[model samples]
Target: TFHSFSLILSVGDIGYYDDAGQFYIVERMKDSFKCMGRQVLPTDIEAVLLSHADVAEAAVAGVPHDQYNEVAKAFVVLKPASQNKAIRATENDLQDFVAGI
Candidate 1:
């Protein structure tokens, strides 16, 4: 005698595969938030932040804003080598970087 079982699960993760059959996790579906009626992906912002040489790690999340309903806020950790550097990054610099991208 044999028994069969069926199972279903929803992980809420977004992913894609490359041409070479390499799998990549883009972001969590639930992690996306809206701002000004536009859905914003935290991973997209994180990618921009991580592009900077000074940024070692970055996390982005939605925060309440008086306008636009919500806005993206970034938490960044600087590279150890950058900490002792005379040239330091400022808020404007990060903002400008994101804006440029």
Candidate 2:
């Protein structure tokens, strides 16, 4: 048995192509928002936020802004390891952590 290539249909999927000409699916159209004229995907930021050692759980949303129309606002849950620890994650620390990347 074999399969044949046919028509392609888009169902709110978002992706990009690299220099190698390979396509990569990154997110869904519904999951993305406009920020500073650029598409911002909450999942992308959530992935970055979850990379932090102190982030036990993370969720990001687009919040209204004066200049940018919208911006990412993350609601994060700190890991138990951060409780009473010297290296606890703070708002500024988390912001800086993402910014540094």
Candidate 3:
């Protein structure tokens, strides 16, 4: 709190894209996550996760965090090959890649 100058800011928390060539922010700031003190875009991470060979589909969501403010939680669907072979990427490797970004 800033002494003698306490204030609150309200901001959009959700976003959407339309076929009409427009995108909109639709939700609250407290619902979002900051990666490296910058907004960690959910769509961006979804794209990255889907790019992995073993991943068939992925959904990224923000998890509550006391330090990072928030962290990403990915719910993924595995490819047939990956499911059969049980192939998987190590958590360290994924974290390293994301950390590098």
Candidate 4:
């Protein structure tokens, strides 16, 4: 009888090696959610939110949506310096920013 041996390690993450033998950890399974039938990685949205000049911090989560089943909602913390700016950012402003991307 011939048998193959496989070993597994509990690293608490999922990753893959690219064609170039580069290892990349896409996202932690627990931190990912479904949005409109697509897998949405929180870090992806967080990265976009953090790209904004006024955004100091951002946390994204999946929220219930009647039509889409789930949608991304962002909680943004603005920079202290931006608070004193003459022009304040509005919801539409943030929406437009993300839409542009």
- Give the top-scoring candidate (lDDT): 2
Per-residue lDDT of candidate 2, residues 19-100 (tens digit)? 5655444444477778999998888898989999889988676777889978888878898764467777899999999888
Cα lDDT, model 1, residue 87: 79
Q: Show pairs that collide, candidate 3.
A: 12-27, 13-27, 13-28, 14-26, 14-27
lDDT tens readout by residue for model 4, 1-101: 11232222133345566656554444444676677788988788889878988888776666677788767777687877653686756778888888788
* Model 4 spans with C-alpha error above 4 angstroms: 1-29, 82-84
Model 3: lDDT of residue 35: 59
**lDDT score for candidate 1 against the true structure:** 0.73
Residue pairs whose backbone atoms clash in candidate 1: none
Task: Provide the lDDT at 22 for model 4.
Answer: 50
lDDT of each: 0.73, 0.74, 0.61, 0.68
Model 3 clash count equals 5
lDDT of 1 at 67: 81
User: Candidate 3 regions off by >4 Å?
Assistant: 1-32, 82-86, 90-101
Model 1, position 30, has a per-residue lDDT of 74
The candidates, ranked best first by TM-score, are: 2, 1, 4, 3
